[model samples]
Target chain A: MGFLSEDAVATFVDVLVRLVETAGAVIIFSGCVIAFVRFLVLAVRERRVSSFTRVRLDLGRMLALGLEFQLASDVLRTAVAPTLREIAELAAVAAIRTALNFFLAREIREEREEIARDTAERDTAQRDTAQAAG
Target chain B: MTDAVRDVVALGVVAAGLLSGAAVALVTRAPLAGLQWLLDFLLAAGLLRLGATGTPTALATAAAIVAVRQVAGLGLRRARAALAVPAPEPPAPSP
Candidate 1:
């Protein structure tokens, strides 16, 4: 009859886990769709590598955030299952997701730098052209 | 419900990957960029799949994807350098 009874706790935890995981998936999918639309529009109008890079960068950021949510769900799962096997599974899943997110972060940083360089190059090229013409 | 959601996202990732890959190729005139874009989305799809399932086999496949992606990325960058492709910069020396 108590709110924190075993049945209530199990049901609450299950619902909580599902909610978190669903939120993560929604974030990732929405990010993908937004980036997809932006990429198409920008690709057509600008046809610039920097623009594409920017869109992809935004997508990567979203994916990283979503992964965090998913990893949180994995942790929640561990709370329910304290057995050795479950913990081992959690370790592996968490490790793989962590590694993926790390690489993703690195790639995002690299792309950001590339965008800066590209902008600089464009400015230099324009300046040179103007100087020659003037 | 979980399986359905995962399947849809997985399919969406594939479709996005192909479309974005082609778009990059067409816009940038660089096959390397296209391939890299494709691989990026592929990794996303893999991670999405892994979120629900954590079997040892799934973990191994995920790790393998990361390894392959890194190796292929390095190779592509090197190929760009060797072919004198105008990289935006010197890749910042991979920290």
Candidate 2:
């Protein structure tokens, strides 16, 4: 049996990084498409623009997840950065992506909280009405 | 540390973040605020460590991101709140 060479290992890592990057891009694209379709369906059925909030939250969550993958790719690229210039470029890219991820995550959290609160209030109102009738 | 090992560690940190985010998203009813806090700390620590030992640039980048995100989040929340509020009613017609 032949053993793998050091060059082969390096090549494998390179391939893996590229694959991860591609996967991240694909996730963002697919997630956005799915969210848009869902939003359209709900809006058409409900005839209310406010229905978009739910879909927007869902999409934001997906985008945040995709941003994680992108940041990972950026970190992986640092491994091969031989020059200061390349490293600087990676830093800039990472900074922008991370900032985007942070806001996206925060937005998703706030939206989720709002939705939960609305549900709780509605449940309480219904319970009160039932008690009054009884 | 060798570049390979460093890369592996960075990848692991990111993978953990992804998993934690997914977990938070899936469990709807429970308040997983603690998990969210933990995730933020973990990512911050990981990035800082990488920057300190392997690349200082990573730390700077992460710090800038954190600052920008905080400001942006505040602005967005304010905008959304404003939109949620109804406009003032028009004055009653004078006889």
Clashes of each: 0, 0
What is the DockQ score, from 0 to 1, of model 2? 0.04
DockQ numbers for every candidate? 0.49, 0.04
RMSD versus native structure for model 2: 13.0
| Pairs in clash, predicted candidate 1 | none
- Model 2, B1-95: lDDT tens digits are 34465455445545544554343334332223323422442443244233322455655665565565456446646765787699999999999
- Against the correct fold, how does model 2 do in TM-score? 0.57
Writing each residue's lDDT as its tens digit, candidate 2 over A25-120 gives 556545545654664465346533234456656656766776787788788877667689777867876886776676667667877898888779
Best by TM-score: 1
Q: Which stretches in model 2 have alpha-carbon errors above 4 Å?
A: A1-11, A48-50, B1-76, B83-95
TM-score of chain B of each: 0.71, 0.42
Model 2, residue A55: distance off in Å is 1.6
- Model 2, residue B34: distance off in Å is 31
> Which tens-of-lDDT digit does each residue in B1-95 have in candidate 1?
37667867877887998998988888889788788777777766766677665467866776687678777876876776678666366566766
